[model samples]
Target: MGVFTAADEERQRGVRRMKTIATGALALMATVFVLAKWAQSAGAGSWTGYVAAAAEAGMVGALADWFAVTALFRHPMGLPIPHTAIIPTKKDQLGRSLGDFVGENFLSGEVVRSRLSAVGIGSRLGAWLAEPDHAERVTAELATALRGALAVLRDSDVQAVVGEAITRRADAQEIAPGLGTMLEKVVADGGHRRIVDLVCVRAAEWLEVHSDSVMDAVTGGAPGWTPRFVDRKVGERVYRELLRFVTEMRDMPDHPARGAVDRFLSDFAHDLQTGQETRERVERLKREVLGRGEVQDLIASAWNAVRTMIVAAAEDERSELRVRARAALLSLGARMAADGRLQGKVDGWVEGAAVYVVTTYRDEITSLITETVAGWDAEHTSKKIEAHIGRDLQFIRINGTVVGSLAGLAIYTVARFFGV
Candidate 1:
């Protein structure tokens, strides 16, 4: 379909009206010229000669203007006139010229910067975004974009990337030193006492419940020559002492057993930090854990869970993520609107970006114009252009006839007065 709209149709009608008016004027001029010539020959007033000259000149002007206007679009009177049909024949050249003109004038970096700076995009944007409704609208659009991006991503691919990244980072950085430092702090602060207490309590409870099993195991390990009753008594005694020790450790926070356990952990922590062998062992264990099928699956599944959570948050308008985003946007807009420095920075950034695009891509932009015009049918292009501007051109013809007639009359009168 043609690109011409209702506006174009209205313009075309205007052009037709102007054409009729101009043609009628020309016809009137010709009729006047004939009548005036006849009157002059029949010894009518001297003014008749002036009228004849004016009418003749008016006809000439109208015809000349009509030819000039018509030549821009098509051949005059269907004659194969050279340099006629200017638009249709030279459409490509005209397009290139137009493209060059735009490139030189409008697409220049200075022009772009000047225009954009005057527009004050930053101030307008800030005011618009400062509104609560506007902020909310922007937040909704951002959420939609985020959801779309997430949906477009493949879970498998993201999971692989995430897993690989984590693996690489972990492999690159040794966790042993950090872990050792943490352990040292925990031990020094008696943080490990709670865990020690738990173990002691659990041990005491188990010993109390499994006393008979513990005794039977001790009795079974006794010499064969010993009496079963004596072995049983010895086993009972061993179980009693074991239970007592555990109960004391559980009741006393500063028990020797707890102190010994702390010392052992402190030494291990120090070894982990200072010993290369210990660090190597820890690293190897880490690699092993990471290499496990279950761990790998866990890592991969973590991405899916995160993606789902993010998508859900994005979809919900009342979600913290959306609410926070809206709040952030509102705050930023307010700051930008109120703070001249921020506004200046924003304006500068915008102007710089615009200038960059204009300077860097101007050739491409101009080429797009040239290419589009080149692609259009030459005859169709001519008609389309004429439809837009033919009405204005017709005014030129009308003005030509009127002005020419006045000039002719003045000249003829002056000639008669001077006896020329």
Candidate 2:
């Protein structure tokens, strides 16, 4: 006997019940036979013979079905008949067939697509994600995933990738035209005015601090043949004129010097955009900048700084970046819940994405079913299947027995009426 757990005990009880019913059927047929034999010995009518024949046929039918059903699970009466113990003997083939059947019927693309469509995946997903807690959960999960990915990447690898990308981008695209266009826009919009103002302010402060340097440059640049006093006077005049010019330029927004500066910028922009010589010079400058070890170091350092900052922000719950991300997620959820138009747009996007996946990779997805079935150990698979579905199959034998008896009785009655 096998080990008897509660489930095994229950299955045993069911088997016993089936056996009892079959046994009772055989006993009933046997009792009918004994009654017919007794009646015949007691000088009963021909009806007794017909009843005996029907009961005998019914008994045969019941026994045959019992044997067929019992043969599946074990040997009938311990006899080694051909095709007996079918489940154990042919379990592997049955499993393969089952696997094939499931692959063909259940895992087909049409079935999957139809089922997904019937489920209203997009609307359901949108409704679920529209909840604030759900959105927050998703955001947290995304953050964790990003953190894990960043942690797994080596810094040297990332630095190399960044450096290569920057070099490739610089090599592929000419920068002068774009820069010139941008510069032209800045100058036209007076966006460079603040920069110019800042420069003027800094220059005035520097001049105030370095008055002795200015006086010395003035004196040194003076002619040697002139008298010392006259040279000093001339230097004083030059210093005063320079100071006055600087003050006027700083105070007067529409000074001629400011106009000259703007005109110079405009011409430079035009030359950068249109002049071949200017573009060649710009290219040379770009090459020089890219060739520098300091530039490469800066590029590598930027990657390191970004990687460190992201890892730190991801690790810290109190970090502003994470807090802002969570708040943004919650706000989006609130909006999605409240706004039908936004929800509809989101649903449309989701549906489109799902459809695209199904259409593009439906074959690969369906092949997973076929491949997985093809890989299973067939005998184990069969046993597992039988464990789940065997109880229901027992009913087939019960129905056959009951139906066979009714047919047998009907045939007997018809034969009696025909006087057979």
Candidate 3:
């Protein structure tokens, strides 16, 4: 397809106008040369000789310049002259040279780094982001990006990845030590006391409400030979003692039973931490739980829940998560804008990253430029370039004509003065 655009067509028209003007000047010079020669031959004025010489030189200069300008884009007069049609014939070489120039200058690591450092991009960005409106806009854009990323992800694939990662991590690291340490801390800080108190209160309440059931359970296990009255008395006594112990434990926080319970938990925590058998049992239980299909399903479902929550929050402009994220971003931006040290750090990071990329891919980038230019059709490229610059080249022909006329007239005058 042709690459000639409307703008190129306009520029071509302008070039044609200038060309016509310059060619007309050449034609006028030739006519003046013929007329002045005839006037000199007829013994009209002595100045006619000088005029004829000037016009002849002007025509020669204009034609020479026209040939030079035309040769750049195409062969002059359609003749296959050597070194003519320079642009069309040498397009690939020119592209390579241009690519090399860019790679050596603009795409160099030093140039890129210096340019970026001078721009102060980090500080300017920070200042812009420090504004409330700018921060809001950035937050909205980030939310949109987050939603798009989530939407592109396949749930089954992500879930499988997440599930495998969790399982692998859990299997690789033993949890007994951490759990034991946490339990020990909780016990030491009396964090489990409230739980103990709750258990005691519930036990007492159950005993009070189920006295008959408790007594019956105690008496029903008596031997058949035992007297019915003795069994009944024993059951009643045992039930009363059990209810009283629970009531005391519930009412008194510093009861001996509470201390005993604390000691038992402390010992259990220690065993969990240091006892080989206990750790092995815990590990076995962990393996069993993880091996269960139900547990696997639950683990996979966790990803869905998280994805849903994040998507919902991203979609909601007024969500707590979004609001907090926006506030955090604004705060960070304000800090970055005001703190010179942070700005410098950011600038250094950006410069380093840019330098690294340019240096690493400099060859590839330059090759892309060279290959793209080489792929362009040479004839079309010549036309495109000539359209941009032909009008300016026409001025050269006009200038050459004027300068040649002046030079020729001066030479002719000197010859006449010397009586040549």
Q: What is the number of backbone collisions in each predicted candidate, taken in the order shown?
A: 0, 0, 0
> Model 1: which residue pairs collide?
none
Model 3, span 121-218: residue lDDT tens = 77898888888898889889999999999999998889778778878998999988888899999999999999988898899999999999988997
TM-score of each: 0.81, 0.65, 0.80
As for lDDT, the candidate ahead, 2 or 3, is 3
Q: Whole-model lDDT, candidate 3? A: 0.91
Per-residue lDDT tens digits for candidate 1, residues 220-312, read: 999999999999999999999999999999998788988899899999899889989999999999999998989889987888888889999
Summing lDDT over every window of 10 consecutive residues in candidate 1, give the lowest-scoring window. Answer: 1-10
Pairs in steric clash, model 2: none
In Å, residue 334's CA in model 1 sits off its true spot by 2.9
- Residue 309 displacement in candidate 2 (angstroms): 6.3
lDDT of residue 318 for candidate 3 = 97
Identify the leading candidate in terms of lDDT. 1
**Arranged by TM-score, best first:** 1, 3, 2
